[model samples]
Target: MRNEKMNTNPDAVRQPLLQVSNLAVDFGTVDGVVHAVEGVDLESAPGETVAIVGESGSGKSTTAMAVIGLLASGGRVAGGSITLDGRELVGISENEMRRIRGRDIGMVPQDPMSNLNPVAKIGTQVAETLLAHGLANRSTVQQKVIEALSAAGLPDPERRAKQYPHELSGGLRQRALIAIGLACRPRLLIADEPTSALDVTVQQTILDQLDEMTRELGTAVLLITHDLGLAAERAQRVAVMHRGRVVEQGPARQILEDPQHPYTQSLVQAAPSIAAARLQPEVFQTGREQDAAADAVADNIVEIEGLRKVYPMRGSASDFVAVDDVSLAIPRGKTVAIVGESGSGKTTTARMLLKLIEPTAGTIRFEGNDIAKLDRAQSREFRQRVQPVFQDPYSSLNPMFTIERLIAEPLEFYKRGSRAERRSRVRTLLDDVALPQSMLQRYPSELSGGQRQRVAIARALALSPDLIVCDEPVSALDVLVQDQILTLLGDLQKEYGLSYLFISHDLAVVRLISDYVCVMKDGALVEAASSEEIFTNPRDPYTRRLLASIPGNELGIAS
Candidate 1:
């Protein structure tokens, strides 16, 4: 492994820490060849953070997997040269790559849930990297593992080290993965959406930790993420990829402040923070306007009174209260956003509202009726009024079914119309969501992330639902696509007078679409107020911390 240090002069150009020239990856399939990555070129300077920004299917992950020699079966690097410290890596043997992976270049994958070993203790998995590189002996490894865990900012590191991956929250699992990546103290680190699954507070902490570690260790970082605001705040340089190609690359400030590429400009404009800056003051009325509107009759659509959901652990003596006496209301044609960290009971509340799970106590009222006490037939009718749009579009939609069939199935199940009428309604709904009729025959695998999400929205709207529970619908999408989805949701609400129970961890998204905001922490509601009130004058300490944790919150506008 190369550990050459560059000159310290600001004017002096440093030698690249890692470089890839004309990289291409191919996978063989029954129908045809899948060109996952094509002629991609990227490089990182020593001690500099380089960000790769792109939408899904832009070959960002494929590039990272290729660099680390972790590509799936049937996937091969067909062409190009990958050089680390001037050494060739394209045709390196598996053993050689494995030796270099953790010792020289480490990686933090996108999804910690699947990346971690469910049955193994997190400490053991983190220590495995040190053992692989011969960095510590069995006697000393335990102490080193604890140190790594602490450095990654896991609370109660000693206790957490003994827990399995399933026992930890999503943010904690991600931190454990980072701990593993940093165990070997590699020269370069590849972090792929490290904070994608974390809440605002945890995300900020992770980013601050990563920045501090990289600066202290003088390690080069290659960050791959869909969050433009995060890239602008953390990275020195940015590379924008589109359709498996680098369409733009330059300094972060230059690209964000004065982007020359159309795609880059679109991404910057579509950023939630930037959009909020342009629209916040207008959408959030002043004190006078709010006072005037207060006298106007407010329309109420859905109400909950002390809703509680408790789950009993099989071996545990006590039950866990996922939703603890949560109470809130959703106004007609308004969006109510629920913000919280993982295991904060956001999803559990949504499940109770959907009636998918029976609440241990409390009342759920939909349009002045007690939904919790409803019979089976009434509950079925209530489901049609309230629909759900789940996260993970890839898994939410059935892969075997066509778009048309998937959309029509909901209408058929509700018995709202005949076959011909349902088919016509499906086409209309597709159009409403800005999807083309041509996509009706295609399967889920044939569509993009944004496209599939649009299909999911169309399916949800099949019954003309009064309220839609959007569970992080746009969190996984790119900036441009997320903007489109948000705008579409707003338009749908305006046109159809549809209400929304939006659940997400992205503060910027909440600021954009939410008329009211609810903050949750540790299975409890910290505060519930108007969006502007929550943003300007949060009564709860946790809510203030969340707002402060947003990237570039100190700045007046989005970076």
Candidate 2:
């Protein structure tokens, strides 16, 4: 938070660096004309951050794309004007827009994998921005790219420059995008959900870097995000949109603390950062059912001891220890979460527990039987009892299949029912996940991101596994939708005596669902305790650092 906030002050007068007046954008679709954005009026003065907060398909990203004249096929601006530094942008020629793109305006798109060229090295991409804008020559561009990458908080920039997008981690890829976006030193920057794909700590670091870079260059920022609390914490002014229109706009903190629109109120209320506690049992099903489930939990369903995983190094006598001697217990019908950063071996530990990978030295006991010694028939049964729900719902599912077939695949493979019975079970699973029956016929691409995640959860439930391994399940979702999915998981846990080995980097989400917590760093458990103890009185310094990185920690919002 800066001492002098941006986009606020009635007395001060200055020309807006970027002004969007009555911006109406539409797409010619097969069904009809899709009114993506209509009559949207907003402005960002120099060094200001005006965040457009809304859910997916609320026209937030579309508005940014249209302003930059990079609208996808079949998309066009129907009415209104978008001006940058008093220059009209809507009716400009493609060549003119290209000239204006890297020189006058820069964009940081949401997905780094799709945004960054996979074939090229990261340094070359950043150098292209500088070279295209005539900001640097071939000789100076390499040094400039390294500086940009270092400024974006990427470690070992010189080595990272030679690597491609697929070789880098998610956070590093995002930093690469930031390096490209800010390389030209543009007057205006449009960041479209720039931090959505990162972890909490990485997200905070990227945002702090972006804020510093834009402030140093005096760049006006048009930030479009779905997290209202994040918008309040980062932006000086907030604009709320629903159904392709700006419903409310005002100072950031004021808008969040005292929202005028009903839609904004719903957003604020549904935010998990605001509601720091678990969802009410009544919100799920009934208090009595939840109480009964709590009363019935008495035994440990899965127990691990001395878990150690070592990857043999290539051309070396040493082995890379991915997981140290770690031990934990998951109580029946309780969720135990493992939290850490990338390369901390959280995913490796989860994979070992799921029996997808073998551990060097470990005793994994499920109901008092060692999993390592499971016979052929028992291994098949273990697969039925334990299921995994991975992150990246987009790629986790088979896009070629319909929603109904996707859900029924698990049941069909497990031989749970006949064709008719499996279809009936698919309908029930959809209801359990709170999705629509009509969605069964739809493909994964046809549904929104949130809808696709819900479908993935439905498919996970088709087999009714005893234990579910959820790895960063809702990390890609918006605040509103993340809360919904967490509540849905809580309700499902109550209904079934299910246990969860939840793996996540988000401590806020872990606090809402997990009964116990384990913090891992560099392949070793630094601290382990109950959820409340871990959050309130963490004994380890690393745990404290992780809690400090949470965004929206200072926002004033009600439960």
**What lDDT is reached at residue 401 by model 2?**
95
Q: Rate the local accuracy (lDDT) of all candidates.
A: 0.83, 0.83
| Model 1 TM-score, 2 decimals | 0.89
Writing each residue's lDDT as its tens digit, candidate 1 over 1-559 gives 0011221234312677789899999989888899888888898876778889988888888888888888888899999988888899889898999899998998988778789999999999988889989999899998999999998889999988999998887779999999998899998899988888788778877777777777677677889998877877788788998888888998776777788989887777777872353232336654345446645854668888888888887676999888898888787878889999888999889988898888888888898889877889988889998999998888889999999999998888878888889989998998899999999999998999899999999999999889999999988787778888988998898899899999999888888888888899888888987788777778898998878777744322232
Off by over 4 Å in 1: 1-13, 26-39, 72-74, 274-298, 310-321, 553-559
Give per-residue CA lDDT, model 2, range 1-559, as digits (tens).
4413443444322678888999999899899999999999999887788899887788888889998999999999999999888889889899999999977888989888888999999999999889888999988989999999988878899988988899787778988998898888788899998887666777778888768765677788889888765687788888998889999998888898899899899888777652365553223313244446546864788988999999886566898899999888787888889998776888989999899999999899998889999999999888888888888888889999999999999888879988999999999999999998999998999998888888888888888889999998987777778878888888899999789999988777787888778899889989887776777778899999988777666763311
Question: What C-alpha RMSD separates each model from the true structure?
Answer: 3.9, 4.1
TM-score of each: 0.89, 0.92
- Give the CA lDDT, 0 to 100, for residue 64 in model 1: 84
Per-model clash counts, in order, read 0, 0
Worst 10 residues of 2 by lDDT: 280-289
